[model samples]
Target: MTITSQDQKVRGKNSYTFDEFLEKRSSLDWYKNDPILQKALKKYAGAKYEQIHNELQHFSSAVSSRWNPLAERAARPEARPSMLHFDAFNHRIDRVVRPMETHQLEKEVFGAGLFSSKMPAWESFAKRMLIHQLGEAGVACPLTCTIGLIALLEQYPNEDIPELEQILQHTKEGLEGDFAIGAQFMTEIQGGSDLPANVLEAVPDGKYYRLFGNKFFCSVAHADYSVVTAKISGTDKVSTFIVPSWLSGDKDKEKRNGYEINRIKWKMGTAELPTGEFQYNGALAYPVGPAGKGVAIAAGIVLTLSRLEIGIACAGFMLRAAREASLYGNFRTVFGKKVKDYPLSVRTLKKIEDAAHRTTAGAFKIYHQFLFLDQPLNAGIPVDQPIELRKQLFNLRELVLLQKICATNEGAEVLRDAISVFAGHGVMEEFSSLPRIFRDIVVNEQWEGPRNLLLTQIYRDIQRVTDWYPSADFVANVLEGASQETIDRFAEQLTDLLQRPVCGEVSEASMEAAEEWDVFCDSFFKAYQKIALEELQ
Candidate 1:
C-alpha cells in the first residue's frame, strides 16, 4: 500500500451521493415507466385503450411529477391538516385548515371531474389507479366518498328533491366549475362496522330531515357534504342521509350547518386527510333511499364502491412500492455490488414485483367484469334473479371481498419488503415515500373490512348460496382457467370447511376450521389473481 499524496487525497475524498437515484426516481412518469401496467390496460381497456392512453400517460406524469411533490409537501409535520374552530370574530366555524399544497392538489384533482358522466369509465378508473399511487394525500379519501355519493344518488333518484339533484350535479359534474367534495360518516362511538347499531336521530322537517347526534369516525371531514347514517326519530332501522356541511349562502359567512367538528383524530396514517368527530344539532339531512332500507343501500352501493376502490388503491400502492424499490435496488451499491445483484435482493424484488403485477391485473380484471355487468351490486345474494345472472353477480361479489382482503394483505407485505431494499433509509420519512405508502397500506387493510370480518362474510355468503350456487361450482367459475386439480382441491376444501360454521362456538374443530378458511381464502384469491395476470399476458 503506497502512502503517496495522491493516494491519500483519493482515499479521503467524499463521493457518496444518492443524487443519481433521486434524479431517476423523480424523473419517472408512473404510467410511462410501467410496461406491465400498460400491458394490463391494453388488454382490459380494449377499444377504449388507445383513446385513453394519451390521457393516462399525461395524468400519470402529472401524478408522479406535480401531485407527488405536493403530496410529499403536504405530508410534512408542519403541514398536517388541523381544525380551526373560530375566526377573528370568535364565531364557531369548525374549519379544517390544511396546507396550501393539499388545497391546490384537491382543487386540481377534483376539477378533473373523474366521475363526470362525460368522462369514460375506463379513463376514470385508470386515472384513479394512478392517483392512488400517491396514497391518501388528502385527496383520495374525498374522491372515494364522492364516488359513493354519486353512486347512491344515481341508485335512488328523486325527481321531487331539487336540492338532491343539485347536490348530485355539484359532485358528479361540478356546479359553476366548482366540484364539491363528499364525506361518509357511518361510524359511531358504539360501532364502526355495525351499521345497524347507529343511533343518530333524523327528525322529519318540512321537506327534508334534521339530524341530531354524533359521528365518531368521520374522514374527509372538510367536505362540502357528507353521507350520514342515522335512524328516523321513531324507526329503529338505520337510514342514510346526505348532510350539507354548510347551508346555502352560509359557506361564505363561515356558518356551519348546525354541526361542529369536536376534534380531529390522531391517526397512524392518512394524516394529510382530516378525520374528525362531529356533534350535530339539527343539521339539514336529505334522505337518499327508503327509510328502512338505508343499511342495505349503504352496504350494497356506497360501501361496496369504497371496498372496490380500496382494492384499486392497494394495487397502486404495491406498484409504486415495487417500481421505486426496484430502481433503488439497481442504483444502490453495497459490498462492492449493486443491491439488485445480491441473491437475497433479487428474490425480494421479484416477489414484490410479482405481487404488484398480479394485484394490478386482478384489480383491472375485476373492474372490467364490473363494467361488463353494468349494474349495481345487490345487497345480498341475488337469489331471485336468473341462475346465470345470479352466478355472475355472485362471482363479482365474492371477488370484490376476496380482492379487498387478499390484495391489502399482499400490498402491505410487498411494501414492507420494498422498504427493506432501501436499507436504513427506508424508514426515514423524508428519505423516501415508501414509509408513508406502507402506513397507508396497513390502514387500508382494516378500512372497509378487516381480514376476519371479510373472511366470515365470504364463508357465510357461500353457505347462504350453496343451495343455488354450489360451493364447488362457484370455485370452478371463479378460478375458471385453473387446472382441474387446482380447482378441485379448493372446491373440496371449501365444501368441507362449509360443513362447520366459521362463527360458532370455540371448539378445537371450529378453531381449526377458522384457520383453514382463512388460509383457503388467501390461497384461492391468489390463484384467481394469477389467472387474471395470465389473461393479461
Candidate 2:
C-alpha cells in the first residue's frame, strides 16, 4: 500500500464537530443529572472532565456508527477475501501513517491549549477522551499528547495568547480526520521498553536534524508524518523530531522514504492494526523539545498522560468485555442452565464486574488529582497547610501509578477469563469481540510507562518518606482529621517496611522477589489511602 500525496484526503464527515457536539449535548438535562461523572469532575474542576464527558457519548456514538460497520463487514465470510487485502493495507495506514499525523496535530493543539487555558483541566479532559475513544490506539495517543506538550514548550514562548489559540484551533481542525487514521513509531530492534538506549542517531544541520535508524514495530505505516525519537550525535541524550512523508522531497510520488517496510508482524491479536518494521536513512526532521530534555520531557509530557490513559482504557476494555460476557452468559446455556446461573461462571462475572467498577473509580480519582496539581486552584492556604498538602500530592502520585498498573494488568486478566467462559467460540474471531479487545489490551500493558518501571518509581517514593520519617507534628498535620486507629495502622505498616531493609544484592531469589515488589508497593499504597481518607475527613 503506497502512500501518495493524492491519497491524502480527509475521509468521512463527522456527525458533529467537537464544538457542535459540545453545544448540543450541553443543552440536554440528562447530562446535568449525571451525578457520578459530575462529582468526579468537581473533585478536580480543572480537568474540564465535564466538558469531555458531555461530548463523549456523542463522539463515541459517531465513531461506533462509522467504524462498527467496517468492523462487522470485515468479519463477514463473504467480505473476507477482498476486505482482507483492504484491511491489511488499512491496518498499515492506521498503525504507521495515522499515528504520525495525529502526533503532529496533538503537538500543535495540545501545546497551545495547555498554556492558554490557565488550567490543566483541559489536559486531563483531552487525555480522558483519547483513552475512552481510542483504547486500541493507545500507543499513538501518547505520542500525540507528547507532541502537543512539546509544541506548547516550543511555540508558546514566542506566541501571544490569541496567536496560540489560533494555532490550537488549526491543530484541532487538522485532527478532525485523525481518529479514522492511526499513529505509530515505537519499538526499535535494539530496544523495546528501554527507549533511552535507542541507537537511532540524529545529525545536526543548519536548522534541522537528519535521522538514520532502523525502527522495529512501526504500527501505522500509512501516516503522513511520524514523530521519531533518535539519539543526538556525539551525545547520549535522546531527541524527538517530526518527519512528514512529503517533506523528504517528493510531494507527489509514493516512493519509499529511505525506509523499507519489511513485513507486518504476525500476532495473536489486533490484526486489524498493522505492526511492522522499517529501515530508514537520513529522514529529514525538525526537533521537538530541547535535545537533552527529550527523555525527561517525554516522561512529563507524554508518559504521564499516557499512563493515566492506559488506566482509563483498561477500564473501558474491562467494561466492554464484562458487558459482552455477561450478555453471552445469560443467553448461552450449559447442562440445562444459563452459563451465568452456574456458580463458577457467576463468580467469574461478578469478579469482572467488580474489577470494572474499582478500575473506573480509581481512574476517575487519579484523573482529578492530576488536574488539581497541574491546573490553577484557589490559593491562600495557611502556611501551616503546606506540609500536609505536599504529602497529599505525593500520595496522589502513588495512587495514580498504582491504579494505572493494577487496572491494566487486572483488566487483561479479566478479559482473558471472560473470554474463557465462551469456550471454543471465544477464540474464534467472528464469534466474539474479545479477540480484538484482547489484542488491544496487550498493548495497554506497555503503553505510557511499563509496569515494572512504574513499580520501581513507587518504591523510590516510599523509600524517600522512610529515610526521613516526618516529625510527629508533620504527620499529625498531614493526617489531622484521621482516626487514631487508621493513623496507627499506616504508621505501623510504614515502619515494618522500612525495617525490612533491601540488601540491594544480586541473586536469583532476590531478583525474583524484586520482580514481585510491586505487590508490596501496592500494599503500601493501601496504607497511604488510609492516611488520605483521614485527611479528607
The top-ranked prediction according to TM-score is: 1
Whole-structure CA lDDT of model 1: 0.91
TM-score each candidate.
0.97, 0.69
**212-281 per-residue lDDT for model 1 (tens digits):** 9999999999999999999999999998899999999999998999999999998899889899999999
Full-model lDDT for every candidate:
0.91, 0.55
| Per-residue lDDT over 1-537 for candidate 2, one digit per residue giving the tens place of the 0 to 100 score | 886666555445355333432343324332233333344444545455566566555544433443333443443323211112223344322123323333443343334333333435544453443334333432334334433443433432333223323334433333343322223364688777677888888888767777778888665555455656788899997776655544434544444455556666654444444566766677666666566656655555445555666666776677666666766777676788989999999999998876665555556556656656653121112245466575666555556677677777777888899898888878887665677677777766775567777777766666666433352332344344566775665566545544443335778755665655656655544444344322322
Note the residue pairs that clash in candidate 1.
Answer: none
**Predicted structure 1, TM vs. truth:** 0.97
Residue runs of model 2 more than 4 Å from their true location after superposition: 1-57, 63-66, 72-171, 175-187, 248-252, 255-260, 375-397, 464-491, 498-503, 508-516, 523-537
Model 1 weakest 10-residue run by lDDT? 375-384
Which regions of candidate 1 are displaced past 4 Å?
1-13
